[model samples]
Target: MRKWFGQSLRLGLAPDGLALVRTSIWPHERARLLAQARFKENNVEAALREAERMLADHEREGWALRVVLSDELVRLWQVAPPPGAARMADLEAACALRYRALFGASPAGWQVRADWSATRPFLASAVPQALLAQLQQAAAGSGFRLVEVAPQFVAALNQHRSMRRPGAWFGVVHGGVLSVAAFDGALLAAVRTAPIPEGADRDWLEGHVAREALRVGLGRPERLQVCGPAPKAWASSAGRLKFACTLFEDELDPLWPDSARLAMTGRAP
Candidate 1:
């Protein structure tokens, strides 16, 4: 049995933009997900709604319901551009300083994992510096309490690797963004998610998965596992993409059930 329950909350920030997901586990786990909502869009209401909805679901289920908002909640709201031309070197130096400050200062030495999707093109003359700057600025605001900022796909892959399950495995995270995590299990070589583009047909999503599958040396996963409950349409769309891998039953973390119990008992809200 798992020692802690990890429930990820994903939010759809704006109309046809990327989604953000916050993950946390219980038992007062020290290795916790930081409170940082990552997205390219400007929509705090959507972010709040996503978090609140997940908490409500957990609470109703009597799970512990440890809700964490963005660690840099206030800073993220500002959403400003960087002051000067931030070359990659400048960006890397800035990120290193920011990461050191946040993660080094944290008593728990915890880190933040993040990934983002943007619908708009040409955010900067080069790549979008605004979003990266905002993310860095947000991390800087966390009082150096977060150590690392990883892509969400990498986070999911690492988490699954920790489980040490063997086989060509496939996992899905469903909330604001529908993410797929596939691994060879032992090596933890690759985990990837591209934004579900606007007017994304099932073929598009499948193509994304297929690309990742190829990247990870999979002609196709032997089996697929889903985390959280996925919508019927998503499943159907994914099904059409490939003739490989059977979807398997997923066990939610026990904390969700506990949260539900507490809500039903009317003992905790």
Candidate 2:
């Protein structure tokens, strides 16, 4: 008795290139590929053209569009409210001041999204306004409504929320950038991202993971789940840690972001 509606388009924009996927949640076909294309990041004109072409071809008047940008362009921060900040506006100002102090620049023209609670403070991601405007324009031009735009790590985290385990380490590697997140079953403890050196050895990755875990006061994880383009040898390395490790075997492709976004939302589009 599931009712499916309009088609959805998901796009991933990364430093290397842009990727697109289209899917529908109709009962007869819950999900199927419509069209996909890629373009190098340096060539903005070409990338825009490809996006427009794909959008024009598959978009219906009211279809939904979602976009995920590469983690490289997003800056994630964990902030606490300033002392005596009682109002939401005051808290936001405190966060902005802290951000300026940390990054040495004003956050003007940046879209800052936050997940916060009174006890936990804030976990926020700041993305450039120009990038969002570009995506918005593309969606509007294509006759589709842009519903969500987030960083890849955020989308991936949302996609795998159900799989998180207490005292576990989860890592996502995409485009040579590795994003590590730790959970304590109830709360997300830490998140960090770093670039993997070219031709990195197993020892290098293991050391990095251990260091990050320690930084987050995790000591060591009971389990590890890695997604995206990780080396095959990582399994043996992880085994040496005396912890359960799983490497997602699916090849990293353009469609992955779309799939993850869909998994996170559970919406037809």
Candidate 3:
């Protein structure tokens, strides 16, 4: 999971805004969106200022925090394992080399995390070190502990990785961004993200799938599973999308639309 136990504050950072959620897994596995605050200005720097204020001292103590940054804030890619790879150094060098190619920048200012592999292509993500430092300082000053910080799509993938199939790709949509992981049989071939277009519908999704498949050098999938706060029209029975589309069934997506009246366990709150 998040490499930790017990409850923690879930901070969702997106371009639209930022949200602070209270998540608990001890007594019950549930999350409630406690508060959302707009940034003073229209950028991530403003969001950081708002977060610093939100974490100011004298109010809360001894809490752990997990900051989930959005796709627009971090970079993600798939790194193929090198041939005859027999050590971790090979994997690290491959990632570092790929980072320069993909980002055209040295990895000095970035902190990288990856699913290391010497036999198959694995996922890699990089986050800005400045962002982490600011959050960590604020949390520590407020008597809170910084437990884990991750990109939103990476977090989602880790949560539902077991559901991934051999041929069908997986996508996570949120805050007008779609993060896709395209696979070739059992190997992860590509990882990419695209912004959701305005007034997007089933037709748009078909086009998206076709384009992503071509870009990743894969055949069109017969079916795909997607999750997030997607449009309801995507689920319409009539004039269905070309491919078989299935909602990535999750505990929260089941009750997300009208969760106010129902609990995470399908009982009245």
Q: Which candidate comes out best when scored by TM-score?
A: 3
Q: Rank the candidates by lDDT, best first.
A: 3, 2, 1
lDDT of 1 by residue, 120-237 (tens): 1111111123433443344333322223333332333344544434555545443334455554444333434444455655455557666778876766654454433333344543
Residue-wise lDDT of candidate 3 within 156-235, one digit each (tens)? 77766777765677777775777788888878899878888999988888898899999888888766767676666665
- Which should have the higher TM-score, number 1 or number 3? 3
lDDT of 2 by residue, 1-269 (tens): 12435556777655445656656555555444455444443555565566677777776677778877767667877677666666778767876887798789989999998775545556678998877887788788878899998877777666666777666677887767778876655566777888888888667777887788778776667777876667666665524755656775542244454324322232322
TM-scores of the candidates in the order shown: 0.35, 0.79, 0.84
Clashes, model 2: 0
Choose the strongest candidate by lDDT.
Answer: 3
In terms of lDDT, the poorest run of 10 residues in model 2 is 260-269
Better of 2 and 3 by lDDT: 3
